[model samples]
Target: MATQQTSAAGDAHGGTDTSPERWVVGVDGSPGARAALVWALAAAARAGARLELVSTYPADFYWTDPYLLDTVRLDEIRADTAGLVRAALAEARRDPALAAVPGAAEVPTDVVVGGGAAAAQLVEQAQGAQRLVVGSRGRSGVRSTLLGSVALHCVAHAPCPVVVVHPGAVQPPPRVVVGIDDTDVSREALREAAEEARRLGAELEVVAACPLEVVWSNIYSVVAPPAEETRARARERAEIVVAEVLGADAPVRLRVEDGEPAEALPRVAAGAVLLVVGSRSRSRIAGMLLGSVALHCVVHAPCPVMVVHPQPARAAGRPAADPAAAAAR
Candidate 1:
């Protein structure tokens, strides 16, 4: 079982029938985790949401000694992890960015330490959370992979949207970029993006990618349409989609680019504070959680990436099984 210690900076904001929204953050004392903590603090403060800081150690650490269950060793590991979470919280309180957001330094917070895989613990803790924030990579991350295993897993299985922040990412202008298509998931992403922009006091940019390619068939070789004409039609379709989802008078900047979605989204989102993408439900292949485009953006986007998963109904059931339990089995 995981142990948790809670601390609050102050009382919850007055006047609310329900409990305050919570934003869960995964911390591991890495530079990447620190970046994530900073972003989460600023966001939580802006939204008046509580922040939960979580850290975990491998439960299998005691497996070498099968005959003896060392409770003392387990307690020491938990204490160390708890201390790390507290240290990260302290540092986040002093971050310049958090200070910039009024009252962000005073957001209420809780610290949770678990004995299990980091991703699983995070996913479990993020239940009913407004968002789950994590570092793009952690200390154990391989240099070659842009995203670490834990971040990817959380993005895949967490019950809420997952925001992955890169360490030392350059702060961009106040703008939220969201990639959209005709899919229902994209519509959800657009709505969430609009809300995020409103909360952050940033402009909203809606982008659609339209790739043009020749059709080669056994019976006929169809040449690709003119670039200008193709672009114009793509723009028209994108405009209609945006209008339908966000109404005709929605205040948003729309852009249609000619390229694959995976490529165009990240390129267009460059220098943006946040890049939002929608992920489809798990695929037929086991352990495959996100679509190619969403996965690509999460791995390559210049700024923090927020991946919104399909709703429960659309997912055909609840979120995927607890990653920690699965790993244990």
Candidate 2:
């Protein structure tokens, strides 16, 4: 039995009292999910949030014919699924990776069974959660998460911020690395980084990548200005935007690298607790999904990556950001 007390919510996405302070984690008996569960335990502990471990089985992975749908077989699968959840939770309790989080053993947890595909079920559960954490790859392990369909789907569609934990990730470092840009999304990223830093009692470092503008493939004039000057401007922009979004009093380290964001971000994330970045938008349109940089981090960063979603226009409180001023050109 899962030590975490649970009650069937009936509805696929239902919960008795869904709270914003909840961190939802998708668990399977896979090595990746177990690693994700361990990371989420510490993260929720840091954020002072409730932890919910949800295990899902293919609700339709049964017979279609009424006569062929053996009730006993279905019952056995449910029982086995429940036991897997229990064992995963138990192992997480004993994981030394959570030692950084005091009272790790005492963090109240809720175990749930979702009846649907793993990605859809987890996304449904994340609707009311403060954040969603998932493993980059699952049990099959044949494909790198860079191309993992389920991880990609959740990254592009989950309602809340999604933290993708690489199975090979080590314990989170004491610093948070955020990719800085001049856009509204980047400002939002800085804000999230600030909050995460405070929550984890860690230092925050801002990194901006400024690639030299290229005129034409046939022209090799380096766009007039040298790359160093662009990098310098990148440093200045990071300082200004971070101060504006996080307040002048915020203490954040800034690094301006002379490369594209896709290259710079993962370089800085080598040993960081979390890599933070913002997606362009989450429209259903194919081209409007995760930005190139954000996707790269999600797929390759050795540490866990946190992709901050843009708040809706009517989300309240914060005034509209001037994209011209906030975004990098």
Misplaced by over 4 Å in model 1 are: 8-19, 66-68, 146-148, 168-172, 214-223, 284-291, 312-329
Ten contiguous residues with the weakest lDDT in model 2: 320-329
Error of 1 at 41 (Å): 0.3
**Model 2 vs. true fold: TM:** 0.84
Q: What's the C-alpha lDDT at position 191 in model 2?
A: 72
What's the true lDDT of residue 303 in model 1?
88
CA shift of 327, model 2, Å: 26
Candidate 1 pairs with clashing backbones? none
Give the top-scoring candidate (lDDT). 1
Q: Largest TM-score belongs to which candidate?
A: 1
Candidate 1's residue-wise lDDT over 77-101, tens digit each?
Answer: 7777777787778877898777678
Model 1 whole-model lDDT (C-alpha atoms): 0.77
